[model samples]
Target: MMRDQAESLRNMVKKNRSVDFQVISITSGKGGVGKTSFTVNLAYILQKMGKNVLILDADLALANVDIVLNEKPKYNLLHLLTGEKNINEIIWSSKYGIKFIPAASGFEELANLPKEQQMFILNSLQDIYYSFDIMLIDTSAGISESVINFCLAADKTVVVTTPDPTAVADSYAICRIISNYNTGNMELGLVVNMTDNEKEAERIYNATNNVIRKFSGKTIKYYGCIRKDEKLSKSIRERFVLTSRYPNSKYSQDLEIVAKAILEGNLPEKKENFWRRILNNWINLKFD
Candidate 1:
């Protein structure tokens, strides 16, 4: 029976290849760097451009994508893991035309789910893998087991960092960790958040990229930056995404440019499905 089920999943993934879905993991080395906010706004912009988007809140222990959008989710990843609900049941659609899978905040079990449970979640995702043009995973800050696993599974990993020394150092740490496991296939990019101007953004990117190149010999692409804006903080307090609440704001414009850069990447051909690759990575994951 297990063999049959596995074969069925493989066939389903092979047959459903009409749409190409790009899986981008947006992560920060340290917490409170606006990774989640950037993810929500990027999803909104992508959806506005007529591409179906899904935001998977992979933070597990501190999911807040729902809070940013002001939507209450009836189910989360815990429900799927416990067999209380299917993956579809946990997905909530927003008015902005993007769908999201909310995570269980402060749940230790989910934070350290075993390999079998992780495979189950990936299997569930296989059912709806072809339903969107892009799936952005907003991972938790720092280098945890979950963070590394998700970053390895993604087609591209976008490291979000601020101009702070600690944030920049941690961001490079993340790149180094990822480079060790990336095998030269995963595309790595950087986004400088809360910058004063373009020069500051470029300086931060250059400094971080230099360290990464020196240590790992891998290149990190510049995905643009988010300028420091008071309206961004106000939008957060109001529980609304910046793109929707203040479209004409400077922060929103910066996000739009960043989103354009993100979309510029060539979408991987659908010869091999993303879910299959994620499942393979999860199965082969080794913890220290």
Candidate 2:
């Protein structure tokens, strides 16, 4: 009887442990660089690692994260911000363990709201503070004020770019804007996507780092690279995450690495929970 009682107490203790939510924002140097794809896949990978995650399609205009997952968002963040509904009324579940807070379509005026309206929106985000293990924000493509605000508000930012010169330049420009104006302590992560090989991706990352150091005086750390794999496009067309639908694909492996790195954070002393430790072990096992 005493042994059973102890086991019950242990189970209760485990159940009492609260969830920790971290906000991660993914942006790009420009549009058509696959930021939403990265965001969705990364969040899916994190969910696979036994963590509860949230994907906020903060891409006010042309939001496609929902469409990619074949979901129709009934309500979005804007609706909650405008007092039309609460967060619980809008967030949708995914096939993966992650939840989604999609943006309301055709809400152009919400993006250009006055300072009062913007503050209301920012305040509303606080409602889901404890509801997720991580909040992944996939912002719009441009470096507009709204995007800047979302980047600054996020706990961390992951900048997506490709080997193309124009994409590199535009990514660096966004990094400069955040460094100069971000109020939150948002550490930047760089992901070089759609590359043929690691060597080329590394070259692009190194060159961009140099440019940022020289011109912006801010250092952008490397997260990981997503290889150019035909399976990535096919998986998107199928409306499933590469990790889920094409687990053996190179793109999925690369995204898993990047997701692990982001969850680990920058400082060595930054502690991770059981899910993160499981993720680290899983990645190491994959490469082995």
Candidate 3:
């Protein structure tokens, strides 16, 4: 890890960097809906839109964002937890200039940290959080504490689901959890991935919102759907981003539309800055 370079970033972040950062957690009710893929591609698009974007790989168990991007981070959250790396040291950037922090399965060990180490973490990350216009958290599937905490903390959470019945049910489950837990008017958006057509995706989005309103008394915004393209699976297997490998594919084109909506739609009332909320992990709650 280049301590000098990372240390310089820490110093630079404090020179009047605004805290108006948007923390959006892209999560799903279940796995296999292409949630991480969407997060990675969206980061690419957001950066291309001239926004400083960072993807926080919050998938605790099966983190494949690195695999999807074809870039392996030298240090990760585990290293920071173990005092082997600082918060800035763990961040890795793709060749495409997409920055991300990969979380190892071993980050499960964070629940048992001592006070000194916990404070060390909070102090270290405060400088780095403002370095991005947006921070995209690719949360793990299901209603795990990590997933719920991230969703609850974010200014917005976009739940990605497919038109499948089971996926729709799980999407409702996630919406319910966030609705019950969130204290503010945190925006919730829906994206139907892998659909064959927009009509099917819209139908699924409406059905999912109907269930949310009936049970949770809240509704989610409909971000446009991303249809599955033939090149999607091929790019994944080849460890290349769909946007870079096949920019003309259906998936990339659909993502650009969603990215536009996300930019226009996600202006939630700001609360505590995201890093402060993360600091709460060791102070008030434990994600593990």
Name the best candidate (by lDDT).
1
Evaluated against the true structure, the overall lDDT of model 3 is 0.78
Q: Give the TM-score of candidate 1.
A: 0.92
Residue pairs in clash, model 3: none
Ranking by TM-score: 1, 3, 2
**lDDT accuracy of residue 117 in candidate 2:** 51
Residue 234 Cα positional deviation in candidate 3, in Å, after optimal superposition: 0.5
Full candidate order by lDDT, most accurate first: 1, 3, 2
lDDT of 1 by residue, 207-267 (tens): 8889888988888889999999998898789888889878888888998999888778656
Model 2 poorest ten-residue lDDT run: 273-282
Q: How much is 115 displaced in model 1, in angstroms? A: 1.5
Candidate 2 Cα deviation (angstroms), residue 164: 2.0
Worst 10 residues of 1 by lDDT: 279-288
RMSD of each: 2.5, 11.9, 5.7
Candidate 3 displacement at residue 195 in angstroms: 0.2
Could you tell me every candidate's TM-score relative to the true structure? 0.92, 0.81, 0.85
Better of 1 and 2 by lDDT: 1
Q: Which candidate, 2 or 3, would have the higher TM-score against the true structure?
A: 3
Which has the greatest TM-score? 1
